[model samples]
Target: MISSRSFVAISFAVVPFVFFACAKGSSLPGGGGGAGGEGGDEWSGPAQSSSSSGGMGGSGGMGASSSSASSGASSSSGGSGGGGSGPLPIVLLRIGDGVTTLSSAAAPVSLEWRLTDGSATPGAPGTTSMPQVISGSNYQLTLSGTASSEGHLSLSANGKYVFLAGYAADVGTLNVSTQIVSRVVGRVDASGNVNTSTLLTGAFNGSNVRGATSSDGTSIWVSGNSTTTGGIHYTTLGSSSPTQILSNPLNTRCVHASGGQLYATSGAGTFVNVFTVGAGLPTSTGQTATSLPGLPTLGASPYGFVVLDLSAAIAGPDTLYVADDRSPANGGGIQKWTFDGASWSLAATWNDGTAGVRGLAATPWGGGVRIVATTAENNENRVLTLFDDGSAFPEIVIATIAPLNTVFRGVAFAPQ
Candidate 1:
């Protein structure tokens, strides 16, 4: 049950990027820095290798030995130091018009990259354009074994690869009645090159696959909407077969993994479903569905959301932000909630008379957290808005970018 806006078929020209003949015999880049252990060493770049991984190292070529040395330093220093100063982390936005034409000439999904310096203050408005675009022809083919439409995207913890989940129709036909929609999972390396062997294809109850996330490097959790076959599904990094984990009859809009929990929000549910993910998979027991207090009952329309484990921020940890896509005039906005040992309570709310917040992401900024959300405007222009978690009412709109005629679906931060 993909949204009409998300599954619409459109005709548009492809955006161009410098194309390099994909290199041969290239090995995948090492997974980037590990999630820094609690009070242990901070996360560092992957150990460098002697052979070229592929393309421009593009913020991914630091030495592996350097990672080892940094870990040693952290062990000796008792983990007192903060994440070291380095190049800004890369922020990747999944871009697509959702056009699924099977004609010989059809544009595929693409990715745009932005560099965040980790210091943008609240209330400071700025506009930044993404400089790099990786087209579907370049990466999707390698990841999915076919040029399929891209839907939701997630970055692996180590930052080595981006996991994508979406649906694809058979090629060389335009008959909607004859189209076969199938779910696909794929990976792209730091160099923006796709890893062909990692392409995973299957079906999810005859519905377009939607949300996806990877908590650990081994397995990925995906969700879709189908009465018979949809719910939450999972598969390992190298496996094409998927095991349906949760078979609830809900239209899951997005899924995220953080702090040992897997959170999923449905476009038709009042509460966000939570599960304990152990060993990279959700445990079958102890699943809880929670909702924000004081919010009007959302009969069936909770859209995109983000979970912030801001243990590093001065603000209390276990913060969650859910985008309510009701019309902006009817209280459509983001509801901020915090877990107070026992349950989640509303902390704050912010919106500016504009609804359609469909994608959310967070990254470290100014020693705190910067939240980026996509607002789908009525005019079909998608607006990217930034906010500082430390701010109050009218939460600081640090930046906004409206990409022309595109509906931005998901946003992710690639570690520096």
Candidate 2:
């Protein structure tokens, strides 16, 4: 549970950038569009939801229990009892007030959760893990579609709503749910009723959107691709149509915002495109994009990027981490670049010595920063690996594990 003091602190912390962004699209990734993934080439921010329903069990609760089923499970997201059991795999992890939620995707559907026990880390000492039954509580809500390949459950700093990504061959889904209890004690009895889910729009809406990210929790920034007619569009949550910002047709992939200035990755091949937010895409949206000039000889082409404030930087304003998955033949690695507002130069390039590193995020753990990446053969059978910042070139693995059986596609992390 977030004490009043913590809530006030987080809100004050966000005051600096609250006015920098102008929301344009339908409901942000989260109901109110909770923020995540900020910076150029990054996802901008995480899902922010605004609905408040109490903690895991009720007001002042201490744990959260949630399950993202594969395709078709049960009405209540929590798995039922009477199945083979063994060591539970920690699927989804999120840090919320007094409660933390973890999912076990394997075996006879089950949700094992633990009370915070006042430990900052719920899975750590003095905590206890208990099985949450599907029919036991009114707070648990079952996901109807396939679990997200990204395997993340984003909770707002306020702990009002939960956001997750789910995708299928023909169906890709995103969700925002209310957290009614502290832990997944079991399924909320059917009679214990509550409206727990609200669906977000899909990528395959056939609307010519190339790439997109939630600018806030309620508005979406969708880029236009070769097939899309609208260059970029913004819609408010619950709105029926999008407001067009540009109409040029370009193969836009990456999207990020640094003030009112929006940046994208464009070009026939691969490049970074810069644009003014709410104005339109760059004039060179057709074929050219700003180049990083001094990038070291990275083996793979840079696929994605995120900007972070390295409190360790001597002079640079921010550091850029790019997913440079050289070719499979050459082995891929993530490269770092330093930016001082005007000039950008390479900082450190670490090769994982394996294949490639994609789905990168700057994770805050153990009071420090950890660079996380998902590695696999074309994103399949993926595993997440964590490394400390400024520790090495590629990354030094501290923890590694498989998230889903399918190819791991994307990864996102909320404040632990």
Give each model's clash number: 4, 54
Q: lDDT for each of the candidates?
A: 0.39, 0.29
Task: Determine the backbone clash count of candidate 1.
Answer: 4
How high is each candidate's TM-score? 0.61, 0.46
Residue 66 shift from truth in candidate 1, angstroms: 45
Whole-model lDDT for model 2 versus the true structure?
0.29
Give the TM-score comparing model 2 with the true structure, all chains together.
0.46
Task: Write candidate 1's Cα lDDT for 87-181 as tens digits.
Answer: 23333443323343122221234555543222222222112221122344322221111111124455654556555564343222232111244
Specify the highest-TM-score model's number: 1
- lDDT string, candidate 2, 1-416, tens digits: 22211111111110100000110110111100011111211121210111111012111211111111111101111111111121111212211111112221211111112111100223422211112223222223222111221222322222222223221111111221111111111111111112212222332122122234443334444443324332444444334344545443233434443223344433223333222343323222332234444443322344334544554545422556655444323424445566765666655444323345444444333333334444433212223232333432211221232222223323333212
lDDT value, residue 185 of candidate 1: 56
Clashing pairs in 1: 47-63, 47-64, 48-63, 48-64
